[model samples]
Target: MSLFKNVLYFQAGFGFLANTILLFFYTFIMLGHRPKPTDLISCQLTFIHIMMFLTGGDICLTDIFETLNLENDFKCKTIFYISRVMRGLSICTTCLLGVVQAVTISPSTSLLAKFKHRLKVYMTYAFFCIWSFNLFYSSNQIFYVGGFTNVSETNQMKVTKSCSLFPKNYIIKGLILTVSVSRDVFLVGVMLTTSMYMVIILFRHQRQCKHLHSTSHLRASPEKRATQTILLLVVCFVAIYWVDFIISSSSVLLWMYDPVVLTVQKFVMYAYPTITPLIQISSDNRIIIMLENMHSKCHKILLNMFLPFL
Candidate 1:
């Protein structure tokens, strides 16, 4: 295999293995513990993580197969479609998560306050809407093959393949770009504005508490802690994602498809999900305790259930 192909395999395989471990630990061990109903935010995060795992796995397998000079077939097409959709969904879900966090942290008197209580209630419906939107938006991708190709009369290599909607269908491309750009912009804006607001609020609250000699208020402010942690996460996410977006967008605009860009894009998409566990671990102590408790309970239950058979 060529060096580029070898790199692709290495990256994809590493991503796949990492995501698999994450999925197992988070979904089975962490998420399954205690069997309590999940909140909106938790459920959304879980869904995104699962999708990320699957997409990573697909990318790894597809790249491996392509490196082996395998021919594209029906299964390849299916994988292509699913991978594209999952990637798009991952972006959408991450943005949704940021939005949810922003809403959660918004002041009670804010316009979003009315929707606060309904977030949990409407979370399922909101996910359904997002899923539906992505399903249709990516439906045209079902006809694609995913692999490297050399552009005519150029040394530039691109990942090009068939799709239901070709470039001739500018309307569809326009709609897709519009939806994608609008969603990304909104999420980025919310993340930045909310984070800034939270910082200012924290500063003001600290100043007022110090003035009043109320150290307890400063220490016990859930809003301040949640806001700060989420702000950090959003910052990390945006930092990685903005670079990926710029590179990918540039590739598309300049029509200079290159293997390096493809590899980087894969890394960024997979990294988001793989590192989420660390974020959760740092942000939410309660969740860690809950997961541990659930694990213990499950172990006891499993021992009791299997002891007789043993």
Candidate 2:
């Protein structure tokens, strides 16, 4: 494979592994194998990311086997359709995760604080609603996109390097346009608002406690670390999301297929999926606990075997 292809595969592979690790951690929490409040929204978010990476793999494989789908419209539509839905679901889940975390740390007097009592239940319902909405909304992709060989006026048939959506009627086209734009705007807006609110809250709390310590710098508390992680996620997300949005919007508005634009967009979309889990694992004490337990168990096993030999 070429360097470009190698990068895409590696990015998708690493993201897939990260999501798997996160899923394993969340699954343990949900199954009660681990002692933690079941964070339903976070579980949903990780699941969605896992699905996104899987669908991306499917797309990548499709690119490799282009000969099979070179003249097949159905094969093209199926891949793109799955991709659009997963992409939409991923964005919605990310926004929901941000909003849930924001509310979790909201001040007791704040409106979001009212949710503190039933946070898990509320988040469960919220995730269900998000999944339902994304499924129905993105279903339009079936009619909006497909594989086709378009013959230009000069009489040459052209197969697009990347699948492109071409809605049949103005109404379908308008709906797709509106939904795509509005979805991104709403999700990005929510993420920005919630993450900033959280960062500010953590900052204020840190400031209040500053005087209690000496002039030496201190390690971040769990809350502060969580806040910083969220902020980093938001920053990475917004930077990549807008760049992907611009390239996608340009592709849609201009109806031009640029290989460079498509590749860059793919890379940008992978950014959050690759980074978020690393931050989660690094900041979470659960991983440390698991590691410590494993170390002790292994030490005991080794001692038993060696002692018996001695």
Candidate 3:
């Protein structure tokens, strides 16, 4: 209806579409071709984004849970918990992606190179651990979030049109906040570290290329392009994540959720997931080539279908 609402709808629709395409691309790669080391993580992240759109009502244009006709409290708990888990997974997978890329680009003599043979094994283990941890960590949402009641303003913070968070004692809130902050900070730190490492590696490689040849000879390799994509994603994720962290933390601590602030926070929070697939799609030459092939095939089919009449 409103401009803001239209933007929200467009954002959700575009993001959902992009993520689905990316997911299918990775799925096809894994099934028919040799998968890259980072393919699994990319696939998982795309899945997470899709779930985020489905369960996170603020980001999704529709209230998907409403169609289920579940009890209000159950619906609230289910949505919040699943959304929290997906949010956690997004960061975890992004961090893993960067770290994997860093390892991928590391020089053969470097220490990280030693793990190259076993990187896939380690990534499988990492996925299991990340999912398990996020599932357990976000369980608190089940207890804290529920349908709004006639509770006093001081005792409840409205989270959505239908859901609100029950007030907890300062100690409980403090503990939850501490753990959340710790996890985010640690993951963000890892992203930054890996990003810096990749930058150094790229710089050195570029320097070496320049020394050996003219400037025009310095084309970005597959590894370099992948690294750059990951770095850009990390920067985008971190910037948006902190903006959301600040907004959410302030709302929780102050026991207030301003309508405008919440709206802005939703936009900020979904921005990363929305843009991630676009970044991947644009940077990935394989996907581009595949798309081009598909387009040409369709064009040939159309010409064949119409040429007899002409």
Candidate 4:
């Protein structure tokens, strides 16, 4: 295989591995523990990551098969649909996560604090509604998408995944497109608001902490670390998503049938889910404690072996 193809496999495989580890850590490692609301949401998010990578693998295979001429771009509707559904789930789960965390660190007197009583219950409902809606929204794929025939410059027959909407009603197509775009916009708006709210909360908490102590004495609490992590997650998600959105939109608008755009789209889409576990693990004290214990054991063993005379 070529270097670029190897790199593609490596990135996708690593992402798949990271997401798998997250699932294992949650399901097996935390099985004995009572699951927190955030933990449950995170488990759902991990599943989204797994699905995202699964589709990513599909994309990789499709790309390889196309390069080998075993398949063509017109044969990609399944992967495309899976990608769309998973992306939708990922975004909604992220927004839900932000809202959960925002409520988590809210001041006792704040409006969000009032929801604390039934927050988890509400979150569960929202998560279900989200995936349900997305599944329905993307179901149009099965109706409007199919293999499209195209001939190469060399007069070779090729078929790839494409919209077979020409025979369908234009009004229906427009309506579906509008609905899809509007739903995405609404989700993004909510994601934006939740992120900003979290930011404001962080700022206020920081000011209060500073008022109570010197800046040098300010230490990041677990809540603070978690808030920061969520902020990073939101920022990364929004940025990557918007960039992907713009690229995808531009491709459709300009009819840019370029391989480079597709490569970039896949990279951005996959990179976030791939690194999610590492980001969460960085803020998790349990992982840190585990690493520290491992380090101490290795040091002790090496010391015993090298300093036996002592």
- Give TM-scores for every candidate, taking all chains together and pairing residue i with residue i: 0.68, 0.82, 0.94, 0.78
Superposition error at 83 for model 1 (Å): 2.5
Query: Which tens-of-lDDT digit does each residue in 66-85 have in candidate 2?
Result: 66735556766766666677
Model 2: worst 10 consecutive residues (lDDT sum): 151-160
Evaluation by TM-score, superior candidate among 2 and 3: 3
lDDT agreement with native, every candidate: 0.61, 0.71, 0.88, 0.72
Residue 206 Cα positional deviation in candidate 3, in Å, after optimal superposition: 0.5
Ranking by lDDT: 3, 4, 2, 1
Misplaced by over 4 Å in model 2 are 33-38, 57-74, 150-164, 167-171, 211-220, 295-310
lDDT string, candidate 4, 86-195, tens digits:
88899889988888998888889999999989987898789789988888888776554455543343222121233222234567756876887887788778878988
Per-residue lDDT of candidate 1, residues 11-33 (tens digit): 54565555454445445544546
lDDT of 3: 0.88
User: What range of 10 consecutive residues in model 3 has the weakest lDDT sum?
Assistant: 211-220
- Best candidate, lDDT: 3
* Global Cα lDDT for candidate 2: 0.71
Residue-by-residue lDDT tens digits, candidate 3, 126-215 = 999999999999997689888898547547788778889888888998899889999999999999999999999988988888667554
Candidate 1 TM-score, true structure as reference:
0.68
